[model samples]
Target chain A: MPISLPDLENAIRTAIPVAHLEIEDQSNGCGENYAIVVVSDAFEGKTTLARHRFINEVLKNEIAEMHAFSQKTFTPKQYEAHLQKST
Target chain B: MFRAAFRSSILSTRPSALLTSSPSSFSKSLLIARRNLTQEAKEKILDAVNATPVVLFMKGTPDQPQCGFSRAAIQILDMQGVPPEKLKTFNVLEDPELRSSIKEFSDWPTIPQLYVNGEFVGGCDILLGMHQSGELESLLEKNGVLPPIEGEATKSSS
Candidate 1:
């Protein structure tokens, strides 16, 4: 069963309380794949692996059912720099 | 043609010593063995992780990755000049137990996991970031996995 995009987001939101979050359904119709970019203060001091691990820990059950998952996590400060650079 | 790093040795010591150690060690060994390949698979995975300079556990071989993320990891390694011959890869599809057990061992949730000098470096996304920042190349070279600087070779030889 493909996990709902909202369900995945809500789980992340509940855990990380991200200020900004975007989910791209990269499943190509399978519904089991996703690409996520999440920004939160919770990530303030965490490494990429630690940030991802936190999210993964929060969404453990959902992740097992996933086919492909990729994420880019950022702290609020780092996300601001990224936004500025992209702009 | 990179061969998956094979474990340098086997766990011929048996579980007897661990059994006598403590309940924690007993359960830990059991986690390593788990349900998939049992004793053999764990030992093989551990051996490869320990012996190889750089190891990737992915969905398919480097020349023919079965997944997109795995493909990305290969590209990053290539960009870093981490030659295929120097790398060892384990296709998780070959063993169901390994696929799941690896996540447990590394406390990582994804495939295309990279390990350097026996440390879990993270999966494809972290590797991509590391590659962009030139950290991956230095990581390899620092560990003596990558070849020495080119100019130094001529200087030393002369």
Candidate 2:
């Protein structure tokens, strides 16, 4: 089943201490595809691969049901630096 | 589907006395057998990854990707100037065994996985992030998988 954006967002929030989260539904209205940016202190000491794996583990069930799931993760400090650079 | 059939065939072939004596041990042995099968698949995957400097296990060919993520990964590699000669792609959709085995082999849950010098690189999101940060270019160059710079040889000669 297609998971709603809010439901997915809530799931992530419940699983991790999220600093910032953005979930964009890329599958039009189907909810099968999502592009998410997650900022969490839980990812502080992890490599990119590790961080992605952590999130992947957390959303295992949801991801199994979805067709596509794209994620970008950052620690709070990295997210701040990224924001500064982007702006 | 096929896995279930295969499992049933294996179970059927086992002597009924053993199956009745210790069902738990029988299942444990079955698990070990399955693990050995995966080990064989892992070796084959290792060979494939080491076959080229840049190996991409994607859903389809670079020219015609079936998934958006796979297409994006191909584009990133192209943008990074990964030489076609140095890169080898395996379409996971073509091989059912490979489709499942690659995931277990990499401990990664997704497709369009890139391997440089037999090392696992992240999927599309990571590739895009690295591409934007200019890390992908340096990585390809460092691996010697990218084409030579246009004017470097002539510049040195001059």
Q: Which candidate should be chosen as best, given lDDT against the real structure?
A: 2
lDDT for model 2, please: 0.76
Q: After best superposition, candidate 1 residue B46: deviation in angstroms?
A: 1.7
Give the winner by DockQ.
2
Error of 2 at B95 (Å): 1.3
Number of the predicted model whose TM-score against the real structure is largest: 1
* Candidate 1 Cα errors over 4 Å, as ranges: B1-40, B147-158
lDDT of 1 by residue, A33-65 (tens): 888999887666566766676666556667778
Which segments of model 2 are wrong by more than 4 Å?
Answer: B1-37, B147-158
In candidate 1, position B68 carries an lDDT of: 87
Summarize candidate 1's per-residue lDDT along B24-143 as a digit string, tens digits: 432233233222435676677788898878899999888899998999998888877886666889999897888988877776778999999788899988999777666777778887
The DockQ-based CAPRI class assigned to model 2 is: incorrect
TM-scores for the candidates: 0.77, 0.76
Model 2, residue pairs in steric clash:
none
